[model samples]
Target: MIFYGKQNVNKVDIEAVVSVLQSDFLTQGPAIEKFEQYVAKYCGAKYAVAVTNATSALHIACLAAGLKKGDILWTTPITFTASANCGRYCGADIDFVDIDKKTYNISVEELEEKLINTDVKPKVVVPVHFTGQSCDMEKMYRLAKQYNFKIIEDASHAIGGEYKGHKVGCCEFSDMVVFSFHPVKIVTTGEGGMVLTNNKDLYDKLILYRSHGITRNQDLMTKKSDGPWYYQQIDLGFNYRMTDIQAALGYSQMQRIDEFVTKRRYLVNRYNDLLKDLPLILPYQIDEANSSWHLYVVKIDFNKVNKAKVDIFKEMKNKGVCLNLHYIPVHTQPYYQSLGFKQGDFPNSEAYYKEVFTLPLYYDLSYEEQDYIVQCLKEVLE
Candidate 1:
């Protein structure tokens, strides 16, 4: 069956991991720093901290941003729960901003309006780069400066994307940017993530937060060390370090990022042309942002299509095509609902969840397979 997304691992990726396996250190070694530096240099960021996964990366990023109890963190409800859960990990209150109807990123207009009208203000705003397309971060950055809130771009889907001619992880518009290297993501490190930042202090904090908050550096210690081996626990942090094996794989994957994104874009354009006449809303593109096309999501207009969504899913699966949903509205989840967030709390996200489904998109999806998937979709919808 065709998958909604898949990773492409070549001979070089395997060789990199094998070399690391033959090396001295497997975890917390030179390969990890090498990978970090490679990604930072690629994205034009001053520093990067690699971690176990995107969820842990977000957790450390929120902690480094000074999020704490009673403080509010706002993000769109249309993302994976990690986007909001990271804030909660810091003991902060979680609130959601509804997504824009067109771009499906956090709405800068609604955010500003909410800022003006709401009594409580967010300490940090996480704008998710949904479907690998960046939000209007320049405008979001302007609002952040005016309102005194920190912006941590949840760029899990946007590693190879660009905004206004700059790379997405450059940290030009936000304080920090996070990237995911899950198997199905644009790049694969088996399971890895990175947090990129330009600020030295935040970088230091993120470094401490990724590894039990222990510091071997003498300058950060409260008192002088007894010997060279001495260290201290500077802050409460977690074990989120990425292994050398993963980093080696990631460093190798970084070399082919452009190739991966280009192929995905080619597939996306083909989908745009082939599926244009269907009763479906293809992914939209804005002028300021060029997407990596990590996902090719289409919204079915139930009004025009006679079949129910579940029936369509079954039919497509039977025909050897596998479609998937990007998300269920985070606030409508039982845990968030228990936090007093009811069904109608965020109308736009709930509405979006009802119709959207991800189509097959990846580096190695061939034209023949894509045509077959599109044909399956057409048969189900028509």
Candidate 2:
């Protein structure tokens, strides 16, 4: 059956990991730094911290940003729970901004309105790059400056995407940017993530937060070192370090990022062209952002289509297609609802969740396979 997403791993990726296995250090070693440097340079950022996963990257980023109890952290409701859970990990109150109907990212207009009217402003606002398309970060950044809130871009779907001619992880528009390297993401490190930042202080904090908050550097220590072996646990942190094996694979994957993005974009165009006549709302592109097309999601106009959403999924599955939903609004989840986020809290996001679904789009998806997917979709809709 055709899956919604898949990783593209070549011989080079395998060889890189195999070589790291033969090396002296497998966890905290040269491979990690090398991979970090490559990602930083590619994204035009000053520093990149590799971690175990995107969730951990977001966790450390929130901690480094001084998110604590009673502070507010805001993100779009139409995202993976990890986007909101990261704030909860810091004991911060998690709130959600509604999504833009077209872009499916956080509604910048709503965010500014909320900022202007609310008594409590967010300590940090995480704008997710949904479906690899960046939100209107320039406007978001302007609002942030005016309101005195930090911006942490949850760019898990957008490693190679560009906004206003700058790379997404450049930190030109946000304080920090996070990337995921899961098997189904734009790149694969088996399972890894990275946080990129331009501020030296934030970079230092992220480094400390990723590895038990311990530091061997004498400058950061409270007292002078007793010996070369002396270290200090300066703050509470987690063991979120990325292993050399994962880093090596990530470095190799970095070499082919452009190729991967180009292939995905090509397939996205194909899907857009083939599915144009169907009763679906195709992905929309904003003029300022060039998406990486990590996911090719379309909204079914159920008013025009006779089938229920579940029945469409069932029919597609029976026909060997495995379509998937990108998200359910985070506020509607039981945990968030118990936190007092009830239905009708975010109308646009809840409306979006009912109609949108992801189509297969990945680096290795061939034209023939894509045509078959379109055919299956056409049959189901017809």
Scored by lDDT, the top model is 2
Clashes of 1: 0
Output the worst ten-in-a-row residue range by lDDT, candidate 2: 263-272
The sequence of per-residue lDDT tens digits that candidate 1 reaches over residues 71-93 is: 99999999999999999999999
Model 2 regions lying over 4 Å from their true place: none
Instruction: Give candidate 1 regions above 4 Å deviation.
Output: none
Error of model 1, residue 343, in angstroms: 0.9
Residues 1-382 of candidate 2: C-alpha lDDT, one tens digit per residue = 9899999899989999999999999999999999999999999999999999999999999999999999999999988999999999999999999999899999999999999899999999999999999999999999999999999999999999999998889999999999999999999998999999999999999999999999997889999999988999999989999999999999999999999998888888888889999999999999999999888889999888999999999999998889999899999999999999999999999999899899988887889989998998888998
List lDDT for all candidates, in order. 0.94, 0.94
Residue 72 in candidate 1 has what lDDT?
97
